[model samples]
Target: MANERWNLNTTSDLTAEPGTPVGLVNQPRTAAQRLTDRPSDYGEQIVPPKPLWYLDKAGEPHSLGVNEPHQFLLFWRSNVGDKAADLDDSYYMGVTGLQGVGVAGHRVTINATGEVLQPGGESSATISGFWDKSDPDDPMWTPIEPETEYTVTVAAHNQSGEFGPDSDELTITTPAVGYDTQQLTLPPRPPNDVDFAAPLPVITTSGGGGIQLRWTTVPNVTKYEIFDNPTPGTTDGMDSSRPGLNSRDVKLGEVNQPSAGTPTVTFTTPAYTTPRRRFALKVRAVRTNSYGTAYSEFSTPLRGALPASTVAPGTPGAPTLTVSPVVGGQVKLTISPPTINASNGAPEYYAVYDGTRQVAVVSSPLGAAPHVTLQYAAAQGYSFTVAAGNSVGVSNPSSALTGTVPTPAAPGAPTAVAVTNVTTTGLAVNWTAPASANPPVTSYKVYDGSTVKATVAAPATTTNLTGYSPQTAYSIQVAAVNGTGEGSKSSPAVTGTTPAT
Candidate 1:
């Protein structure tokens, strides 16, 4: 309703001309007398001249026919933008028209907000010449009648509700009804009568091999257009007024919202070459309507690196495995970075795997021997491998490394020893095996008075000692042996005696 309302002369400037009776009603005053009124008499101030439109290189107005869709450019200025650093302010273009005969109260007035005008240049906006019959109650946009004469005037209204003087009148006469040739397409009005500024896009890696761009979805935006600095090495100079704003940009692509209720749109680069390249990117939102496509301002530029290679790096060499001596000790795997070439590219990090599953990833930069330690059960065997990886992808795994943790201790002592026969020169002995053995017991040893007398294979608990003198007494002991070496001698040595000859 505020758009439709306007102020007009209401109070007469009539005054007594000496002989005229004072306080007379309906008395008319001269135009000169109204001009002499004090400033206080007028409640509003006049702005710039009325907005003017289309003139050719010859400075002559172009003619339009009612049968064809007609459009024209409207130019106007405000107090703003008088200086170079000033920003353009929003304003309404007030249009009023008369058809055939000039009639009171029958004229139609329409106020529409136009596109933003840049400062320090010719400020202009495209305006439609005719209105559609979409609204039965609103006749301001109704098409002109055939062969009828129409009179139109445009004025600029500031946001503060002050109207400037009207422009020179624009008059048109419709041709015969059959003269139509072209259709008129008007641009869609901005949402809520205000233009939108596009939100900036966030650039990052797509995780696998390429660059990714993400941004917030704007309401009324049907699609988004992506732009990149044409040159890979140049930074974006985002001065909107300069020709570089659009001239230097290359349109990468455009995308629509994938689905409803989605708040973000993502774009990943296609497979890229090895030795990744960098990019400077920006985005803009667009909406299409009956009038035409409307675009939000371009977002700020973002710089990011793209994937280096499309192919995965080459397989790495086998890693070396080290087993600690103590049971349950850590097993360390030292990985050497894979060799890099044109075919393999360079690896960013190394991945350590146990059999087919990945156990850990070494995030260290390439060219270093990454040491990874894992706790292993005592004497348990393991098989592991390593691989190279980068943003592009992962390489084939390296040769497998197999090993086992060192046993924490030797086997437990042998038990249950008994001497069977005693003679002048020899004796027979047997014993029960130890209960626990790391790496499994492999042999047994016999000790006579602190000297190793004999060695026997595992699972055997019997032995014969034959070097004793005829009437001598001897102390005998047995111990278990395994991969970790022999255990302590059996406790409480058995006493044996030889008979005299």
Candidate 2:
């Protein structure tokens, strides 16, 4: 062998310096001097002494390092803020401990070209020659060939290449073309599953909420971007652009090479707030490569939320809130007759509540009985109950029911009324609130024509029924009631359907 074939696995007792780009005078070190395996003399230019961490190979601290900005001037000034940018220029790597010996020969074999460069080539420079560590301005030149393989070797003049040995030939070549950077191009990379939150689900009167999220597992990706838009409201990430990039469509902290698939994340909401809320999401894969390759991108089509929060099977029951339901802006329910004196001939008022929220309070000074014809309005399938509140104590909530109160009845025949605007869970039934004689009509009844479908024990009109079979029809009718008793069934029947699957 021309040189010593030393398989030196033994770590060098000579400590190597750690490299951190600091008051770097912009002087560059050659790639081979990266000290990745073993620390060699890392050639650094005279930079204004600032805070710098001096370390040995393997990242061990050789000593406490605090390079204060010294009398030296800052080099190659440029815009400074978040990231350290490199200036455009050619840099050289230097040698140390050369003492009296000189680099007698040097050679670099290129992979693709198969050509070699030595001491003096038009493109390559002799990195090793008469080594001198004395001058701070000492410079060394090395050469590089594109898309090629290279094996480099250096030796001294005093010895016939018997001491220091040669390095493994690094067959330099462009990464395997068209490799799925996510798969083949590099070492086995860890998967990057971008940032994700609880998905926006299709809320249903059915109890459980729906949630869908944006996700991907990519290789070499740094940040995974997730954002959403609520169909009924606004999507989660809908606030900014999808993947939330800037004018450059480059979002910060995004990852690259995400794995395939749009995943879902679930979360629960308080049952009563109607599915009036909805959303959509976008997730992206990002990669910041050492080679500065373009970032990879992927987006998804918009998704919708399912409606929930509506009236239940029973109207005058628990879990239901009687909201005015007219949709001006936000209708807050305020109590009336502040302090009802039922004992002083004042009529007892009936109230509707939303999950303990009191919306409407109704009572007449004339001491009117509970209205059978009036229907309290609520969302389609949420639980609700009506309480006859007086000046005294409050009453227990009625059974849990979903939907609005039924309409009043006509004195004559109630005809077949058709229903529309069907949702997955509930329906709207409209009919006449039955007629009254002497005093006034209050309570009302809606039946599947056989059994009482739903009843309004207090004064109200128009009810939304929840928890119904989807796309199914039901024969419905409304009747009147008062303290007297149940009135005759309405003449005509009405029908409505639940949402189709």
Candidate 3:
């Protein structure tokens, strides 16, 4: 019994050890027993290992170009040991100008998590920032001067609240600030009714019949040059390099540092003489860099006309208006213009008005049908009027036409979808009613991803889908459908496994 160990949970007879009862004195614990008695004091504290970091330009560590000298992406790999805890705490990254191994220069701290630290918070492994020399007062976490060298490093605390060692340092140099070399493309032209165009631009004649032009903005562009083809029906090829108006075109005007919102310019038209005049307009973008200025291609040409008349046109005949339903709560209004006559100045153009508000103006070389689409809310009614116009003035409004927009309730996505039953060859599914069932949901579509499995009628919440393989998993979703079309599918697809035969 000298070398035997006793279990603390069991009752042992002292007399079993022959002479143990005679002395009954305690003996020193063995080395193994002493080691097991204080387990917490033997191990080292768990702390995250230092991270290994690298700096790169667009993922290339050694090939930073002149244009990307200042821009860099910092990346690192975790240096976690077997006993180290998971990295679940906020980590800090920093960059500083370096002169020598121990020399200090400008320094800035960047949060690798892209968020401010809070107690018990975690963040992403990567973050991006830039240094600007031009604006020292700019509000940024770590602003660096251009054309300067800097070193980057990272560190983070372990779950045990111990800060790990800093990652290996990476050095980088900032590039000079300048314009991008890529050519600026032409800006998208404003929507206009010039024919076969996706967006039609709206033109309104201002006081004194001046023409105001409007268009959308282009990215990375600071200037715009407007060109006009004075001669009707002729194409004038214009670009940034050849912005000058050709023999048949004229450089109307230029806009510098266009505003962020809608861009526009106005031109004064000559006094109306006798007949009507037509003009084609186009616009191009301009960008200036250190090298020089570059231009984009000209946008699609927009056609507009100016009428000449000293007398107002005669009142237009009662327009024959037809209303047709269209998508997105809109109705198309088709107006048949009156026959051209000397009294109406040949019906140069027509104006469509919604109540007292002018909705659209359409040019008509001669009497023709002009169609306009107006947006309306559900159950909303609109009254429209048409007026013929010449260079002199607009004629009296025609008789009013009224129409009502249709209300179609499009069902929302189904909710609380779950699997009801599963068989080797078939699966059953059910869902709750959609939040919205305007016009009432007529049917429901059961989908496995994009593929439709079955169509179930309304008032029914369950459907058994067939043709599925045995011992297989299926992710299913349900969608409600009404006259407006199928609604979005339910989120968090419910998965079901079929029983094997």
Candidate 4:
């Protein structure tokens, strides 16, 4: 097909030709017509909106104490006409720099975007990216000095990568460390007077065997530091070489300036069992102001001993004794321990007494049963008592108990039987009871050779046998009688010779 040109003037006329070549009729239009026909070309470069300002904490500007950190909050509209669809690509906020205005002035960049000129082309000063508030991590500026004025500004970038106008500067100042130099005076040290009235360095018994200490307050003192030592005179002769005279001493605690109606500060001693723990205490007063802190010299060392707790275990209950059968001339005794005092501490041990004398000491009452074995004769009786003891002291003795040694079989022969008070016609015989008598001897029988001489009641140490020939020697023997019957005669009969006139 041969190419031919068609002169179609308007879009309507060009569409009317059916067999006309589409490419020939379709031709590029002039720039002016294209510009007029196109969507009017109303688009322009986007500019970031100005940011609204606020303090990081309180909405209004506030004073910062010495060493306080400065922070701010800046927020702006990120959307532009056509760029509003791309929020992440459209805009970003930056803190330019903090400028200190006047004497002792300086400048520090808080946020930057790598631009050689100032951020947002606002200033010619150098910039930095040391801190960025938009960053979640490490989002704080370098702290400023107290008593200084600063102007903080922020800039925003649009999708075209161009920073718009800077936000209005916010002026702030950190507060000064305010105090009157003259008011910073050292407080007077506590007095060394041992007689400084009650409640001042007063020592009292604390609950659970401890000591409590209290002291009066000094005027204009903001804090009081206390020192304590086990040795007396430790605070004496302290030189400048030892800056803190009581440096060796332990610091108990500090007392801050008390509120109204509270006149004294008290320290309760820790729970301890050591009796009479002598403590040397010294107190120094301190005050702080713009001139700094001042400490007074340590007061005179006051010594006091910790008193024992007044609460004590109650008296022990009566003890019971159980005697065992005698074996080999000895008897065994088992004692039941006493009950403990519920209101106070338990006893340390028990004192076992035989009559008025303390015979043994049982260290633990709740441990093994208090078992004791003692050598005893059948005729002898024993009395026992018990008393509880503790760190404080011993308690009163419990009720007394009486026991006797047990014996088996008949009574044994009497011992130490002899003849005394010899005369011309008569002589007296003296004897003692058997050592191991089960039923206990009721009477005694005296014999002259093979003939029964006389009978006497039991426990009769002396007996007279008259009608004896003078200058004659007679053989005599004694026998013990019990409820069962008479026991064997005494061995080795004693020979008695009466003197002739």
Clashes of each: 6, 84, 9, 0
- As a TM-score, model 2 comes out at 0.24
Task: Report the lDDT tens digits of candidate 2 across residue range 312-336.
Answer: 2112223322243422222233222
lDDT for each of the candidates? 0.57, 0.37, 0.56, 0.54
Tens digit of per-residue lDDT, candidate 4, span 21-107:
454345655433433443433343223444334323434422121222233222332223222212232223212221111011112
Error of 4 at 436 (Å): 59
Q: Which TM-score value belongs to model 3?
A: 0.29
Tell me the spans in candidate 2 whose CA falls farther than 4 Å from its real position. 1-94, 111-117, 120-164, 175-488, 491-501
**For model 3, the run of ten residues with the poorest summed lDDT:** 97-106
Most lDDT-accurate candidate: 1
Ranked candidates, highest lDDT first: 1, 3, 4, 2
Q: Is candidate 1 or candidate 3 better by TM-score?
A: 3
TM-score per candidate? 0.27, 0.24, 0.29, 0.25
Better of 2 and 4 by lDDT: 4
Top TM-score model: 3
- Tell how far residue 160 is off in model 1, in angstroms: 28
Off by over 4 Å in 4: 1-188, 191-215, 233-242, 260-273, 309-501
User: Candidate 4 has what TM-score?
Assistant: 0.25
Candidate 1 matches the true fold with a TM-score of 0.27
